[model samples]
Target: MFINVSDESITVNNKWERAELAQIEEISMYPVALIGDVLQRLGMMASVIRHVAGKATFFGTVLPILTWEGDNLAIHRALDDAQPGDVLVINGNGEINRALFGDLLGEVCLARKVAAVVIDGAVRDIQELDAMGLPTYARAVNPAGPSKYGPGQVGFPVACGHIVCNPGDAIFGDRDGIIVIDRRLVSSLAAKLKLQDDVENNFRARVRASLG
Candidate 1:
């Protein structure tokens, strides 16, 4: 269920299922690189989208926002529907000339308990965002600001960082980059992630023993 407010140039989808808290917690134990390995490296976002500020890792259900190039009016509107465990995944059309997110929005996200933010564009205020410790990543950084005039959509599928992201999808991000997982796959992938993690841990233990 979604609402299209033509006058406002925004569309909001009101219905999507979030994964269980336990499931999200279970998956968060693994690194983003390990999860990508388990997924056969299919869901990893482009490397150009690097961690810019805040914590290095975060995991949450996705709240996808698609905005016009270099504009972020949709993001402001999307926050009205944001939940604590939600991650704001914005597809800013890969525009890096203007920052679509910054410290002000970072504060808002902190207050709302947003799990993380990944922008397929640009963001600014790196120092404040880092101090605030909200996990944030983007394609680039520019001090220039963004336009509020929106022709955008929220809760819709967005192509962020060269990968398609659907609302309610599970997102895990780290220093390497972001990965999108389907909500339906969380349970099944959780087991695979554990198995792979165990394999890597054993390998590391073996290497340490050899070194000793």
Candidate 2:
């Protein structure tokens, strides 16, 4: 059940089911690194995609957008379909020369109640973004703004940070980096994540006792 809009330039798929809110909330309690461990270290985005501004933690269903390098028309269209808990996962072809997001878009996202933003490219307006408190991550920062031309895709699968991101996939990020979890795997990973957290907590406690 996907809506496809095709033209000479841009394409969009407007339909995908989000993970249950309860499931998303439950997974949010675990650390992103621990979740990656439970996924056998296969779901993490590349370390190059670091936290660039705002809060360091965010988790929500992905809304993937693919845009031409140095262009951002598709990003604007994607927002039209955005839901309250979406994380805009943009694949800007890893182009660091031009920023694909900034403070004005951040304001729109906040108004829309978007959870966060992850870009495999660049972003600008760091001070404004940080003040706005929208969790944002990117490969770099550039003062160069993006062109608004088309030839992009929205609500489709995109390769970002060397990992494939699909709309409706659960994405989590913190200081460590970003990780994607398939919607189907969300429920199954909860117990494993909890157990690993407990183990790590106990190990840290033992190290503290030795020091004492």
Candidate 3:
């Protein structure tokens, strides 16, 4: 289901199944660190939401933008409504006035088996989230409150960094940066990314050996 609120789109899908084909493609094929390398190659700042701690990696489908006056109503709605392996993309418009997300939300997401949370605004309770091992990427962190007013959407196309995120697009983020692969291109991109990772690792190994 999708909720359209003016400029925002929120998607709610209780069904959670990693696309079998995608999973097969991932498993049968050798893994590559393509997403990380892609960011470095592009010389773009489309990665490393940088606000998270611990194993701050993220990859999954997008549940588009949601709005709140510092209250987490829509966010909660999204949670109760998110499919497993879905990434929650909150468009806070880069607002740093208050904390857009916190430990409680993080806990809920973890419990629901959600993949990650990406916000263009702010998040708080970093210590708890990190302890819980929840993956979150955001512009900043603040200790402010949120509103629970109207005006939020789900299952729509939203913009993050320099990429346009649509529902089901593959979003992968690591230390290097975030890579959004079009759902249609996952198979091809996966192969290319895996190749890139192998080549890069071989180069790194050779360089290390020569230094020794």
Candidate 4:
């Protein structure tokens, strides 16, 4: 597996093993509007990456940045090296002119057991991808194809909305929005998230009784 020198220590561990992951996934199944309120209190932004028109939740490590107007070399490389719970985050500037992904790449990712892909760009071959049950989040859908030029970077920090993502940062996305959580902060954040849930549940019960 190819790895950048700086990310040598970044072992690809299954973050789902952490109790926090299950907790987060459980919370995510709730109404997104409610989740947004919780995220706001937690000081996290929900980065939206809409597909052409479908529903799916994507969770994985952020392999940040696939340079605009260039090939997906870094993405391919990252896919080769990525473990099961890794997402390929391509910052395409929301360009709908060209497709950043297709069935071929998706197949490789599926074979490798990649978690999902989040693109602030275009993706093609929607039906095939959907049928395969591959979780892909992108800004738009266009038949336009991307250039396969050489040169790109991986395992580095990149931007998605107002957040910066390192290669191994845990990424969570559903119909609501994409949330990037720093792996180091998971333990602490988990505690706070539970508190938020408790308050919300209490509020729900009160509202229910009022309605009755």
Q: Across residues 1-212, which tens digit of lDDT does each residue of candidate 2 receive? A: 11233334778888788877688889988888788888899889999999989999998999999999998878887887899999999999899999999998898899889999999999999999999999999999999998876789998899989999988999988888889988989878788888899999999999999999
Q: For residues 121-165, could you state the per-residue lDDT of candidate 3 as single tens digits?
A: 788888888898878888888888786554665666666665677
Off by over 4 Å in 2: 1-8, 210-212
TM-score of each: 0.93, 0.92, 0.76, 0.78
Worst 10 residues of 1 by lDDT: 1-10
- Give the RMSD in angstroms, all C-alphas superposed, for model 3: 5.1
Candidate 1 per-residue C-alpha lDDT over 1-212 given as tens digits, one digit per residue, 9 for 90 to 100: 12233327788888888866579878998888899999999889999888989999999999999999988889888887899999999999899999999999888888889999999999999999999999999999999999887889999889988889988889998877889998889988888988898999999999999999
Please write out the lDDT profile of model 4 over residues 1-212, one tens digit for every residue. 33232333222322333224454455445444444465573423335566443347766566676555534555665675666666787777667788878887888888888778877778899988887788888777888777654355666666755567766666776666667766665445555556777898899999999999
Better of 2 and 3 by TM-score: 2
Candidate 3 residue spans exceeding 4 A from truth: 1-33, 36-48, 68-71, 205-212
**Candidate 3, position 131, lDDT:** 90
lDDT of each: 0.89, 0.89, 0.64, 0.64
The parts of candidate 4 lying over 4 Å away from their true place are 1-48, 53-55
- Steric clash pairs (candidate 2): none
- Order of all candidates by TM-score, from best down to worst? 1, 2, 4, 3
